[model samples]
Target: MLTSIWQAVRRAVRPFAAAVVTALLGVVLLSGWLDAVDWPASGGWVRAHLPALAFFAVAFAFAVQGIGRVVRADRPARSRPVGLSWWVVVLAAAIVVVAVTGATEWLLAEADHATDRGAARVDAIKTGLGVGAGTAGIFALLLAVRRQIHQEHTAADTVLDATEKRVTELYTKAADQLGSGNAAVRLAGLYALARLADNHADQAETVLNVICAYLRMPHGRLSPEVSDRHESELQEAQVRLTAQRILGDRLQRFSQNPTWGGQVDLTGAHVAGIDLDFAGLSYARLDGATLIRASLQYADLSSASLVEADLSHAKLTRADLEDADLTDANLAHADLQGADLTDAKLTRADFTGARLPDGMEFRNGLVVRT
Candidate 1:
C-alpha cells in the first residue's frame, strides 16, 4: 500500500520542490496511515500523543533518506548554502528534532522505556543514532537539490548562447544582402533587417544606423554623372521612401514608447515628400538637403544644419529649429508660427507666405528691422 502511494507522490513531485516534497512524502507514507491501523487503548491516548506521532513521522522520513544516500553514492556535489554550512544547518535541525521527539515521548508517558537502567541506556543510544542518521540524510538531500538547480541553470545558459549565435549569423546575412548592387536585393535586405530588428529589439539601433547610412549616400539628380542611369534609380527612390517610412515610424513612436533614440545624419542628401511629422530629429545634419513639401510639424530639428537647402512649402509649425542654420535656404510658403528660430542663421533665406514669430522680421534675416 505504501509502495503504491510513494510511487504516486514521486510522479507528482517533479520539475522542482525536491527537498520539501521528498520530506513531505516520506512523512505521510511512512507514518503507517493512521486511518488504516488501529491504536492501542482509547482515542484519548492517541489524541494526547499527537506530537509523538509527528516525531515518529519525521524520524522515519530521515531514515528512508539515509537508505537513499547508501544506494546513490555517486551523487553530484552540493552547492554552498547561503550564510551557513550544510553540516551546521543539518546539526541544528537534528538537535531540534531530538528535542521535539524527546518532549513528545516524555509528555505522553512513553518515557516509561527510559524508566529502567539498562533499557534507558539503550534507548538513549538509539535516539542518538536516529538523530545522526536524520542529520546526514538532510545534508545529502540539500546538496542534491542545489546540484539539480545548478545543472538547470547551466543548460539554460547553453541554450541562450546558441540562440545569440544564430541571431548574429542572420544579421550578417541580411547586411550582405543590403550591400548588393541590385536594387531588388537591397529592398529585400531592408525588409529582412527590419523584421530582424522587430523580433530582436536590441538590434534596432544598429539596423537603424545602416538604413540611415544608405539614405545619406549621395544618390540624387544633383549627382546624375555617377547616378544609376537605368531604371534602378527610380526603384531606389521607392526603396529610400520605404526606409524613410520605417525610420519615421519608429521616431514618431517616442511619445508612446521610445525604441530608437539615435541621431540621424542626412547631410547634403535629398529628402523630398517624406512624412517626418512629430519625428525626433534633434541635432540632425540636413545642410543643403532639399526638403520640398516635407511634413515636419512639431518635429525636433534643434541645432540642425539647413545651409543652402530648399524647404519650399514645407510644414514647420511649432517645429524646434533653435540654433539651426538656414543660410541661403528657401522657405517660401512654409509655416513657422511657434517655431523656435532663436540663434538660427537666416541670411539670404526666403520666408514668403511664412508666418514669422513675435520680435522677428524676415528682411535681411534679422529679428528686428534695422
Candidate 2:
C-alpha cells in the first residue's frame, strides 16, 4: 500500500515539478545569469512600486471574484450576510502571484529602456500586501475569537435557563401534589413550599393555617412527643399558638364565629408575646406561671393573682399592679418604671431594679417598705 501511494504521488508531482523548474529557469535566463544579475537595483525598484502595484492586484481580484460569486450564488443574498471561509485566502494569493508576474516583466522592460542602472537587477517582487490586508486579517481574527467566546458562554446560559425552568416546574408540581394528597404528603409538601418559596408565595402561609385549623387544636398542635404519624394534630402545639398570634386573641374571643380558646377557661394561662401589651387582665389567676419576658407593659393587672410567678424581664412598666398577688414572685430585673404599686402584697418578692411611683428604687433582692 505504501509503495502504491508513493508511486501515485510521484506520478502526480512529476508534471507540476517540471513546469515550476521550467518557469524558474525561464525567468532566470530572461533576467540574465541568476548570480550575475543585480539584486540591489531590483530591491530598490520593488520598494518604489510596492504600494501602487499591491493596491491594483487586490482591488482587481476582489472586484472580479466578489462580483462573479454574487452573480453565480444559488441563494438570494440577505441584507446582512453571515460570513465567509478560508477560500478567500486562496483567491487573494492567486491574484498576488499573477500581479507579481506582470510586474516582473514590466520591471525588465523598464530596466532595458533606462540605460545606466549600475549593478541594480531591477527586481519587481511585489510581496507586501499592505495594512489593508493586515487590518482585514486582524478584523477576521477578532470576529473568530468573538465567535469562539460566544460559543463558550452559550453553555452557561443554557444551564441557567434550564435551572430556572426546573425550579418553576418543581414549585408547580409540589403545589399540585399538596392539593389532593394525603395528610402526610400534603403536610410535607406544604411545609416544603413554605421553606422553599419566596416570601408569601402561592398562599403557603394560608395553607399551613388551614391545616392547623382543620386539626382543631385551637392552633396547629400535634400530640406531645408524637412523630407527626402517630395520632393527630401539630407536633409542638405551635400551630394553635401561631394562629392565636396571627388571628388576635381578643378577636378570637370577640369573633362572631367562636373558637376553642374563647370557650375554654384561660384564667392562669401563661400567654407571653401574645400581644397582650396593654390588655385588661384584671382578676385573672396567673400565680406561679412563667410570665418571663411577657409584654404586659401598660396592662391593667389590678387585683390579678401574680403570686410567685416568674416575672423576670417581664415588661410591667407602668402596669397597674394595685391589689395584685406579689408574694415571693421573681420580679428580679423586671421593669416597674412608672408602675402603680400603691397597695399590693409584697411578702418576700424580689423587687430588684423595679422602679417605684415616687422615684423610689428597688434595692438588691428587696422591696422597700414605704
Candidate 3:
C-alpha cells in the first residue's frame, strides 16, 4: 500500500504540480455541493487549526518563491535545511489539516453524530496546492530574471571590446596616410605629434627635432624647448640667480601649431649659458650679453647679433654665425670648427686658446703670452 501510494504521489508531483488545477476546481465544486445538500458540522479540529493552516500555507508559497533563485545559485552543492524557510511550517500545517479532515470525515460517515467532512477536506487540499504551486511559479520567474541579466551584461562587454578594436584600426590608418604625403602632410604630422606629447616630458622633448624637420627648416624652434610660467626655476633667491636651476623645466612650454618662426631673441639679457643647440636663432639678438661656456652647436644664428658678448669656452661647431658681431668679445678656448663666420666683425676679440686663426699655440695646456 505504501509503495502504491508513493507511486501515485510521484505521478502527481511529476506534472510540475500543475495537477493543482483539477484539485482546486474539485474543492470548490464539492464545497458548494455539500452546502446545497444541507450537511451539518463535520468536526472541531478543522476549525481549531484553520488559522495555523493559513499561516503555514502562505509561508510555503513564499518559500517556493525562493526556489528558482536557490537553484540558479553559483554554489548549489551545499545542503539546505528545510526549516530554514517557512516551507517546512507550510507542509506541517497542511499535513495536520489533511489528517484532521480525514478523521472528521470518517467520524461523520461512521459515528452518525455529525455531517460529512467532504467540504472541509476539499478546502484543505486546495490550500496545500496553492502554496506549493505558487512557490514553484515564483522560483521560475526569479530564474528567468537572472538569466536575462546575465545575457545583457555579456552583450555589453562584447560591444565594448569591438568598439575599442575598431578605434585602434582607424587610428592606424590615419597615421599611415599622413606618412606618405608632402610638405603639408609633414606639417600636419608634426602638429599632431606635439598635441599628442601631452605630459610626457622625455617623449615630448624627443619629438622636438622631428617637429623642426617637418617644418623643412634646419634649425629647430627654440619655442618648443621651453614653456611659459616655468615652475622649476626662478623660485625665491634672486629673479636672475636661480634661472639655471629651472631652465630644463621650461622645455615644456611650446605651441602645438606648425607655423613656428624659428627666432630666439635674448638681447641684452644676463644669461649664464647661451645654449642654442639646433635652435632657429635667425637674425636674433644677443648684443652685450654674457654667455660663458655657452653651447651653440648646430644652431642657425644667421645674421644674429653677438656684438661685444663674452663667449668663453663656447662650442660653435656646425653653427651658422654669418654676419654676426663678435666685436670686443672673448673667444678664449672656444670651438669654432665648422662655423660660418662670413663677413662677421671679430675685431679686437680675444682668440686665446681658440680653435680658429692658425698659429695659435697650445703651450702647457693653457693659452700663454707667446
Candidate 4:
C-alpha cells in the first residue's frame, strides 16, 4: 500500500515539475524580449508577481492529487498489497513546496520597499509547521501497515508450533501402546503407527524402523518366555503379519506416489511363511533369519544379508541378488530362473532341488555349470 502511494505521489509531482521548468524558461525568454521596449517597468511587474505564480502552481498540484484519489477510490483493491516506507517521498515533496513558498516570499519582499519582514517570517514559520504535520501523517500510515504484517506472521508461527507439539504427543502414545501384553492393544498400535505414517509423510521412515525393530524381537520357540504357548504364539504371529503387511504395501516399485526406500533391518529375525513377493528389499539385513517357503518372487535383494537363513521352497524367479550373502543358507527347491546371483556367497548352502538359470550352478558358490 505504501509503495502504491509513493508511485501515485511520483506521478502527481511529475506534472508539477514540468510546469515549473516551462514557466521558468518562458519567463527568461519574455524578459529578454521585453528588454527592447521597456526592461524596467514590464519585466519588473512580472517578477514582482512571483508570489501569485507560486500560489497557482501549488494549487494545481493539489488539484491533480485530488483527482487521483477520486480515481483510486473507484478502483478495486488488489489481493496482495505490496507496501514500503514512502515517508521519504512525502518529505521530499514537503521540502519542494516549502522551498517554493520561501523563495516567492523572499523575492516579493525584496521588491517592495515597505514590505513587513516580521510578517514574512511568521508566514514562513506557519508553512514549515504545516509541512511537518503532513510528513508525520504519512509516516504514521506506513508504520501501521508494517505492524499488521508483523502480527500476521507471529500468529501463523504460533499455530504451526502448536500443531507440531500435538503430533509428537500422539506418536509417543501409540508407540507405548505397542508394549502392552494384550494382543488387541498391539494390533491397535500397529494400525495407529500405520495411520500416522500415512498421514505424516515426514515420519514414515522412523515409523517403519520402529515396526521393523518390534518384528526383530526374540520370538523363537527356544525363547519360551517370549512365545510360551500356542495362544501367545498365535497373537505374536498376527501382530508380526500386520507389521509385515504394512511394510510390503509401501514397497511397490511402480507406484506414482512418493514411497519409502529406507533400509529394512530384520536381522536374525524369525519371519517364516511371510509373503513379500515383488517387494523392494535391496541392501536389507536378514542374516541368520528363518524364511521357509517365503514368497520373494522378483524382489530386489541386491547386496542384502541373508547368511545362514532358511529359504527352502521360497520363490526367487527374476530376483536380483547381486553381491548378496547366502553362506550356509538353505535353498532346497527355490526357483532361480533369470535371477542374478553374481558375486553371492553360497558356502555350505543347500540347493538340492533349486532351479538355476542356464549355464549357472550352485555347487560351491554360484559358477558356470560348464
TM-score leader: 1
- C-alpha lDDT of all candidate models, in order: 0.74, 0.58, 0.55, 0.75
Runs in model 1 lying further than 4 Å from the true structure: 1-113, 222-229, 253-257, 305-309, 325-330, 343-353, 367-370
Sort by lDDT, top down from the best: 4, 1, 2, 3
lDDT score, candidate 3, position 25: 46
Which stretches of candidate 2 lie above 4 Å from their native place?
1-237, 243-270, 355-358
Q: Model 4: how far is 88 from its true place, Å?
A: 13
Tens digit of per-residue lDDT, candidate 2, span 164-227: 7876676676567455425565545545544443333444334334433333323232334657
Model 1 is weakest, by summed lDDT over 10 consecutive residues, at: 34-43
Predicted model with the maximum lDDT: 4
Q: Quick one: RMSD of model 1?
A: 14.3
Q: Give the C-alpha lDDT of model 3.
A: 0.55
Tens-digit lDDT track of model 1 for 50-115: 999999999999998999788567667554334444445544564556544443344334334445
Better of 1 and 2 by TM-score: 1
Q: Where is the poorest 10-residue window by lDDT in model 3?
A: 232-241
Superposition error at 168 for model 2 (Å) = 45
Model 4 TM-score, all chains together: 0.62
lDDT of 4: 0.75
- Between candidates 3 and 4, the one scoring higher on TM-score is 4
My TM-score estimates for the predictions, one after another, are: 0.63, 0.33, 0.31, 0.62
Residues 1-370, candidate 3, lDDT per residue (tens digit)?
9999977886566353444644664585568543343223443555778999899999999898798577457555533222233443344444444444444444344434325456655554565456556655565676577667767877887996897676545445434534643534433444454444443343444344343232232221233245663342322112222222222222312324323343444555555564556655667666766677778777777788888777888888878878887777788888987777777776777878788633334354433333
